[model samples]
Each structure stands twice: as C-alpha cells, then as structure tokens.
Target: MIHQGRLKEDSLMVMKIVGDAICANENQLRRYLSKRQSASKTSSTLKSLRKYGFVERHKSHLAFEEDDEISYKPPAPFTLGIGGYKLMNHLYPEHSFTQPEQWSKNSLAIQRYVAMNEMRCLSVEAGVLRGWSWNPYIGGSAKYRSPLAVAKLESPQGEIQLLMERPQMAQNFIGYYRTKLEVYRYLYERDKYFKIDGFSKANLQIVCLYVSSSSMAKFIQEEIRLHTFPFDIWLLSNEWISEEKGMSEAFCTVNQDGLKRIRIPFLAPKQM
Candidate 1:
C-alpha cells in the first residue's frame, strides 16, 4: 500500500546515518538524499524522527562515542526500509517483537497487520489456507464468484479487489485478498453466467490471508456482522473441504475437475 506520505531523501538519509553512524558524514548523506527523491516537503522527515524518539541534536564539538550518535529506532507500527533490519539487530538484539513468532501475534509489523488488522482487503479461494503451507489450491479452482462481488462500480473511496476465479503465480498477496463459493456460478450459470437468475456467483480475492489464524473465518463473519466495506465474507467448497480446518458445509460436492462453479449469497448483518 502506498502511504499517503513522503519518503524524503533527507529523512531516508537520517535513517541511513542511524544505521551506520560511524561512517556517514552529513554532506555526503545530503547528496545521497538529493539524488534519490524529488523534494516534496520540507523537513517533515526530521520531524517524524523526532516524534518517534529516534533523533537527537548534537552539541558543537560532539563527544566521540558509539552511543553519542542518534540512537533512534522505528516505532512498533512503522514501516521498515532496507537498512532498518540490521540497525534493529544492532540496537534491539533481545526485543521479542523484532522477530516473527506466531504465538506473539504483535511482534513483527507484518505479523501484526496479518493477524490483528481485521480490516481485510479481499477474500480467499477455497481449500487454500489451513493446509500445509504453499499449496496452490488457489489457482486450481475454476473462475469462482464473489462473496461481496462488486457490481455497479462501488465508491472510489473504498479498496480495490482483483476479482478472480483463483490465485495466480508469483502474485503479491501481501497487499490483496481472495474468496470463493461452491455451486455458486455453476447453477447460476445454467441460465445466467452473467447473473440472470438473481443469484450471487462464486468469487475469490487474496487479502483474507492477513487475518489472525484462529479467527480468520470469524473475522470474515464479523465483517459481515458489522457491514464492513466490499462484501460479507463467504467460502465455496465440495468434498475437498470434508476435513477442512475451518469449514463446516459448503455449496457443492467436489467431483471431476472441470471449469465450473455455483452461486452463494453473502450479505451484511441486518442491524448494520
């Protein structure tokens, strides 16, 4: 996601200096910053550093010591650049949150966003998650339908979901979501591949994987319960899901592999 903020070279340079305090000089750093980004704002980068407690002004005739230089660290929810990792290892060698620990869901920024940021951008294809990791059940299924499929070009202020039948190879799901429903498009397609029967078609997105593990499905339900943007979360499955880690009963029975699907309706909670 593009942050609605700037990454000024000066600020980025300060980040570099903090990473390697011993070798960097301000003039060279300034040159580097000038080369990387076109100037957009003033010193908000410095202001941000000060706000995050990562910078300190030096006195004339600066005392020489490793700790005398800026000892700033990025905030817990902040994004990291290329140099931040080594600096993190140097400054916070023992901090638990710096690592990826499943049980400690909030440690890493990616983990926190994946697990706790219930604000999902899309849904998952059937039988993908809860399996041995890296299974491409995603692209396997034929073109499914959407639980919250977009129809009339909804508001531009909301997020964008790449409506797909399944996952694609080498795609960046870190910024996406997926979803699907069995029997959704198949029967719906008999007369309405384009929705003449007024039934919803099966669909998928890639962003749903970001939800915390135990509550992934529940997060989908709650989004429906509270009327989260896009559409209510739903899944499509057949015999493939008889033992699925989180599925109960889905739209149809898994049979011979074919380019087919069914329809399923997904709506927000009534009170919402």
Candidate 2:
C-alpha cells in the first residue's frame, strides 16, 4: 500500500492513462510507459495501484467449444477504480470524471475494447496520436449519431482528423454499418462535421472502419465503393493491426478506379 506522500509521479501517470483509455491491459500500459520507466517497474506500480483501489482488474473470458463443451480463456485488463475517479475529479475540476462500471462478460465487446486500446497505445508510441475522444457527440442535435471514437493525428500536411467506427460482426451488422455510413454522409452533405469542444471546426478527413477479418474488410470496401462521399473512407482488420507493423500497416480505401492501399502519413516506422 502506498501512502499519500508515497504516491509517485509514475503511479499518477499510470492512473491518468488508464482513465483516458477507460480500460487497458498490462501490455498496453507497458508500451505507454516505455519511454519513462522499465517494464518491471510498470508491473510493480500496477500491482500497487490494484492493491490500493486506484485501479481494478477485469478478466474477460474468450469462450470456445471443445469436445462438445464450452471453455474460456483469459487476458485481464484494468480500469479506473473509485479512488482514482475521485482523485481525477479533484485534480481536474474542469473535466467530469466517472468511475467505470463493470464490463459485461461478452467476448466480442471485450475484444473490440482491447483492440481499440491497442491502437491507441501503438499510436502513442509512434508519436502521432494528438488527441482521442471516446463516443463524442458529433452534432448539436440529438438526431445526429456519434461514432465509436474521434482522434487527431499529427501529420506533415496537417492534423489528420478521423471519425472511427468498429462494428461487431453480428448477423445484422451490415444494417448497422449502413446506418452509420448514412449518418456520416448526411452530416457531410449538410457541411456539419464533428464539433468537439476546445478544437477548431474542421472537415472530417477520414472515416476509419476497423473490422474483425480481412473478408469483412473487403466487403466494407465494396460497400464504400458503391457510394460517393466527400471524405475518404478506409478499412482495416484485426489481423492486419495485430501484425508486426500494427497501425503502421497499410489500410484499404476505395479510389476512382478501384480499391487502393494507403498508409497513414503521420505514423512513424516501427523501431527495429
């Protein structure tokens, strides 16, 4: 247990990262803290934070069937606890902080959340992630829809603004995807892009869709090709993101002729 006086700067930084992400696994945390501290130090700090109720562990199960019986797997993640929330609220009075609720046992939801956090960590390492907002409101009215996340990436050209979506590959997922696309198209036609507080009004540069498989990604590409939009639409899969280059991997987008592979301009090449 750490006393108030003993709570080090590293620990506070860990809490802030976790709070910003909503949840993060041990590996992601290590990557985020790599520049300032060693892996072993991060491990010990996490243990202390968990012990002192600054963070809570959540083990999401991966269900599978073997020999006609269902089984489960593990990769526990961490979220901010009550103490951490209170501390953040007190320290940053301008921003409202809420304690995260217990995550559902659904495997798909957990997987998507973990994958999003992985992208965020990778972006941080590449030094391109400027800002990230989870489920932020896009328009002033209630009729408008919100994307899964909004991010700003620093590029030589300028800041690359993205409205990101990651739909679950369920039976009716296509319908959901179409609806989300329509909403963005409507907003685009009306000249109303994302109006985030403390940021200048900017056009939506890209709509990034992160799917479950390469097949799904190809299908989404075809769907996007069928439509006309002012902004770019890109598709990436879990397989590609989990590869050696991670987010530095090329993403697929529709062009005038056909599908084309494009890389984010700002992402630095992965260090060997």
Candidate 3:
C-alpha cells in the first residue's frame, strides 16, 4: 500500500526531488513542496508510478540506501538531483548550469515570470503529459502506435529537466472529467456527427474529443464482445484514438491516408 495515485508532472517531480534528497518519502515530499492541490490528491499521486515500481513505501518509515545490489538507474545520461546537475554541466558546456561564471546579470535577460513559464514548460508535469499523450505514435514499421503529433523534449539541467508535449489529453481525471450525463450527451452528439460522416462518405473530418472516456476504453476492453453488424464504423481523428480491445475481432478497419485515426473516446459503455 504505497498509496499510489495518478502521477502528474509536478507530483512526479516531487517524487524525484524528494526521492533524491538526503532522506525523503511521500510525507517529506509534501512538506517540502508547495502546491494548490488537495490533501488526498497529494496522497494518491504516488499510485500510478507504482506501475513501474519506481518508488517503494514502507509501513513504518521510508529508507533510502543506495543499494549496490539494485540496478535502478533511469535511461542513459539521466539522473535526478545534484547528480543531474553535475551530469548536465559536464555534457553541455555551453548551457551548463554549474558555472555561474558563465552566467551574467544580463545574460539571457528574461523576466522572472517569463523565466518561470519557460521552466514550467520543461518541468516534470510537462514531461509526464508528453509521455502520456493520447496522440498517435506508430514506431517501427510494424508498430501500430504512431508517434506523438507533438513530442516532448527533455533538456537536462542542474537537478532539473523538462518534458515537452500537449496538455489536454493528460489532464487529471478530477474536476476535469465530464459528468456522467455530460459524457452521455457528448457521446450522443458525437455519435450523431459520426453517423452523418459515415453516411456522407466524407473524405476527412476534424472531431474534437478527449481520451478519458471510460466508454471508449470499455469498448476497447470488450474487443472480444464485438459482433459484426451489417454496417461498418471507422474512427478517423488524427490526434485522438479510442482503443477498444474487443472490436478487432468483431469488425475490421482500413488504415486510410497513413492514419488509422480512431475516435478512441466513443465506445459503448458497460452494461450496468
């Protein structure tokens, strides 16, 4: 019971920050970071990353001893805290953060607000979004997941870094989630629109949808339940894909224009 929750950018950074400190845990991580989120939110933020088993929680206390037995380093040249700083300084002489002599009162003269904004763009929050994009990412000739429409960039700095990507798709499923009624309304409306497009045989269309739709995920989950109907439906959105699992067996789709754009958010909901 590490009390894991969805890992947001800042939360992930908090984990990295506190995790790298002399001795820190979720409790200590909170005490050191100031944010506008709630108490429970702060607690649950650690849950999702447990998927990767990145952090471990103890029943009584959190212990951090650099275990020689463990091989838990992030991908190449990536380190979290002071190690990150030192690594970046050595790797990037021109932009090395360690040398203040290289910095000037007027060097990169940017307003505090502007500088902060730039920092935010390169922060853990932004990086998580980039990593979690619902965007189509197909890698390797045979891989179906297309590359992200807008990719994330990681810039190493002294104990800091950035993740580049779009924001909406990775939104927290809190107040951001639509009400059940609202979701249904949106579903009906979008379904109507798609029906029209299907009947119209439109060459292309732009459909605005989000990837957090449970109905969509449900459809994918029930891919086994997909039954062939006389009619066929295809999703065609570049950025959004509704991955329904059972649908693969029930129906067939055509990859059009180097895009198998699926309206990934429009699957039928579970039967309650």
lDDT of each: 0.30, 0.70, 0.29
Kindly give the stretch of ten consecutive residues in candidate 3 with the minimal lDDT sum: 157-166
- TM-score of every candidate: 0.19, 0.82, 0.20
Q: Which window of ten consecutive residues has the lowest lDDT sum in model 1?
A: 127-136
How would you order the candidates by TM-score, starting with the best? 2, 3, 1
Clashes of 3: 26
TM-score, candidate 3, is 0.20
- Residue-wise lDDT of candidate 1 within 1-272, one digit each (tens)? 11466444556455644333222223323333443553332134534654654443221222112133533332222233323544456656653122212213432223223211111111122211111111122222425333222211122233223222222222332222422333333433353333311223333222222222223333333333312323322323322232222222332212223212233222111110
TM-score of 2: 0.82
- Between candidates 1 and 3, the TM-score winner: 3
- Candidate 2 per-residue C-alpha lDDT over 4-89 given as tens digits, one digit per residue, 9 for 90 to 100: 76677888888887777777788888888888889888888888998888888786653221123334444478878878888877
lDDT of 3 at 164: 16
Ordering by lDDT: 2, 1, 3
- How many angstroms is residue 201 displaced in model 2 relative to the true structure, after the best TM-score fit? 3.3
In model 2, how large is the Cα lDDT of residue 99? 57
User: Which pairs clash in the backbone of model 2?
Assistant: none
